[model samples]
Target: MVTNRLWRTLSAFNCSTRRWAPIPLRNTQSQVTQRLSPTSRKIDTLWTQRLSIISWNIDAFSSRPVSRAKLILSHILEGPKSPDILFLQEVTPDVRASLLDDARVRAAFLVTDAEDQTSFEDVPFATMTLLSSARFAFGLDSQKESDGIEGGENFMLGRISRVALPSKYRRDALYVDIIPPTAPGTFFRLINVHLDSLGDTLHYRTHQMEILANVLREPGCSGGVIAGDFNAISPEDDGLVNKNGLVDAWVALHGGADPDGATWGVGVERRNGLGPGRLDKIAMMGLKAKEMEVLRPGPIEVPRPGEEPVEIPWSDHCGLRCTFTI
Candidate 1:
């Protein structure tokens, strides 16, 4: 292989002799190119083929009335590229307009409200987006009796009228399966859930857990991932959630330990500090975890004249992400 001029220049900048021995620039370039050439090619090939899933909880529409989920969406796009499959929780129909206005994004989002007894939310004024004009299909997965675990009713997420779960949980979870444009028919399943609150008296959390396990075990649910505000600690802390066959993207990359040692300080009136509470999570069953991390930016408030911005009062939760290759 012929080395390019750029490589030669880079070689010169990196060339050096050791105090005992400075490494030569030629040596560095040759070593890096020899090692990175194949790796770069593999990376490029993977990017051209894989589908990524992202899971996040943008608090509630009420948190930041101006653009609650919008802010969270912006935060999700902080890095180089946006997630292809986004599993979002607490995405109320209250402000769907601001979210769909951007034509650059091919988004397929769903919203469900307890007050509505229909398949979709009763917000007729809400705009239905055309995420793609291609052959791609889209629909809601409302909790249903048919899709639930053997012992439970089928559950679906979204505003669709589907079989309902036997449980009387107030809100429903959402799911989005995206079929990539580049690779037709090749896709991934993304399940987003906000399990029952810790303070709730009902056994909804247990039931939800079972339902989730059942969903993953079902056939045809491959090349997928399940994530969102699990509302529970890591599987390491709770025997209830067995990592069995799935991989905890975050733990797999950052070690199965407390990656962020920050305390979940007592808020409102709760104090389940450092040890047993990591309410947010990202888990994968089939697709590989390329990269994963919890993004908790310091308070980002609205900017003032010559003053820095601070954290908005929109959400009380942090964003967790996992980039995967399918």
Candidate 2:
């Protein structure tokens, strides 16, 4: 059971066994078209906005300190290039609170309920989340899994549930139908996932990936994106991260794997966790891609603007942000 802030909600609509309260994160995406002039249609600010999506594992507060969470929010929202559509993994309730409290963050984006929120000590750690601006709206809140969208499923962000997992693993993936304000009928499915950790074998990861592929390839599905901490070192790991005919934006852009693209840290390396591997990722299903960037500014702690004394560590894994010019 996850009880999170509407600042962020702990929801997996299917997790009916757990009772929860929904936090009211305001989203003024729907503003009635007021007539200001004679014979004129009201203009929507988001009509021509291009989506700038991001996927990150902000290193939850359950394991890390809250100060680090604050720094993470600062880098994401305070930076010059904050995202318009963000997909996050490993978000705990405490960290979610920090994110919600950030005046800049709240002013810019509306967050969705995270998966498996409040898991440890009644607080969540390493859960999945998706947040967006007015240009992109969640079709359904996490609480409405598979319930279908009101008005029209075509217009709402439909909820998607997980397909398979090990009996011991109780984690859920973050899936939502993103309806772009500019394109009314076109919906993009976004799945933010965190697979099993290092101890889990290739077979275990492969099973999870296959199940995820099924979710992405559902009938009537137009196009989608799959991203998050994939826990993969290479494309083919005994069928791990089944790709499901999706394109890896990093691989597509760089021709091959680059050391900078690694998202997971391993071993006992103090400077960077596990020596850094491309554990985090962004990929697309049946969609065209334009830009992909691995946003790591060298080492664990990167210097932010005007914060000389503070060299904030971006995260255990660097974030992935991409632009899809569809």
Candidate 3:
């Protein structure tokens, strides 16, 4: 339960800024079509505009950070089909640098959090989001002249804001407003979050979810999607989606929690001897989940300083990819 003290603390740290600065890359790809056109010929067609997203915790504290980061990036960017939006948690400075420096990544997405600025100074790891550059440009161009003047806020190009959550771990939620190409003035929020970890911090995670849920329900927000590492090790964490008025993408697509949907503890050995649990998830409001699948990139052989190479999973946790319709 969130108390008055927690609310006051959250208010103090609710500062926002435009973090979605575009990388100076030429758009060589074909322009993306308007998926959520409000004036469609058929109302049922509105539910078929698919937006694919991927969320993963990259395990910053793992060994061979550079190798792990490279492997992860290759699997995501060089895959058969790239997702429209990406949410990555537990990213260290090295991992962040690698991501920004990749030519393929630079050519594809408009990323949040530049390499120069430390978004989470107090913590060793931070969350990062990447939006399709073509789609972003489409949204910017589709904005009407009157839309930018509403509430003295410019909706052009959209915006990214960070909300500091009340946590000893210095975790925060990163929000990005995405303008639907067909909807001139309407937009949906995409949130990347890493909630409090460990079993004893249930109260803190609950409070954090409450704050994020309110952000999703705020005025002017059409709908939103929240994805990242929840660190859900206890039973109480299961009810968070329903309690917060958010639908779990995995459950919504599968009808219930599938045992094979577990995202953590399966790839790597845990010192605490804990088994696998679904620590990472995608939750949404005002969006329909069409498909959801776990991304297990498996392992890569890393050469040691003075020994033979050994195989290891890119991260301790697997990633999730989901397709949603507005």
Candidate 4:
């Protein structure tokens, strides 16, 4: 009789174990199901914040054994606000370190073939560079090298997140996919250019502008910006300034039109004021120009720190900056 009771007790214990066995698994099953579904996973993905882009074309001609470098460095560091995306023209690879390594600024993309001055000692020329916030990935588009001007390499960069280019323009424009910190599906692109100098024939300059316009109209361009020293006095200077889809930020801010903000009036008169010709400008495509300003000559520390702050008659032109809300 004791043995029979023992067996009956064992059977009851086994039955209880079976009933409770699935309790823990039942609690976790819903969680597993939610994670495995595609729609739920997408909803869980977070996005970056909206982006603020600040761009400037630092005059490249003023470098000497010491003075030019000081002038360039001072202009970059003293901006009203630190730029997340700094588009600089007349930058040489040599001076790139000075600008990038400044305790105040961060480096992103320094395009090869585009950087004209490699060092402080190198003669300054047009060095076009595109800088982005640390949050974004930027570089040259090596694949498009064929489309670039002779000896020009198509440098490219983008954010780490996924983004798409819009299809519209025909030429191979610089393709960049930007994912803002807060917005999703609002990515955009930026194209850097230094159109023919005023010294270049009108035909040449006009052709260059036409090419630029065609490139911006290409597919995968989406909403983007084209910026740099256009060298044109004003949109009306040539028959080419009419709105072909892009907006002129400088014109919008100052009214219908004004003198080119570039202080250098003529290439030869580059030292003190806007040179004889209006040689610097910033233009935008697809995006509204929020605010624009021409960074004027300020008291840059003369190459010698012990020396007093002096005006840098560095390049023939001053820098033009445009800030856009994206």
lDDT, candidate 1, residue 308?
75
- Worst 10-residue stretch by lDDT in candidate 1? 1-10
Candidate 3 structure quality by residue, lDDT tens digits, 1-326: 11000000112122232222333322221211113222222222343367789998999886887788788878987898788888999988878777766666665566676635457566798888876653454233323332453332222345556667878687888777765555545568898989999988999899888777777665556777999999888889988988888999998888665788889987556788888899898999888898999988568787798999888788988999999887
Using all chains and alpha carbons, the TM-scores for the candidates as numbered come to 0.57, 0.67, 0.79, 0.57
Model 4, position 270: C-alpha lDDT score: 40
Error of 1 at 208 (Å): 1.4
lDDT of 2 at 256: 51
Cα lDDT of all candidates, in order? 0.43, 0.55, 0.71, 0.43
Q: What is the lDDT of residue 168 in candidate 2?
A: 38
Clashing pairs in 3: none
Write one digit per residue (lDDT tens) for candidate 1, span 68-181.
556666776555756544555555555443443432332222222222223235422211111121122231222222234332221121112112222344434443344443
Q: Which candidate, 1 or 3, has the higher TM-score?
A: 3
Estimate the overall C-alpha local distance difference test score of candidate 2.
Answer: 0.55
lDDT order of candidates, top first: 3, 2, 4, 1
Residue 255 displacement (Å), model 2: 1.8
RMSD after CA superposition, every candidate: 20.4, 12.1, 10.8, 22.2
- Cα lDDT, model 2, residue 260: 61
Off by over 4 Å in 2: 1-49, 61-64, 114-124, 138-156, 160-164, 180-186, 234-243, 266-274, 297-314
After TM-score superposition, what is the CA distance of residue 308 in candidate 2 from its true location, in Å? 18
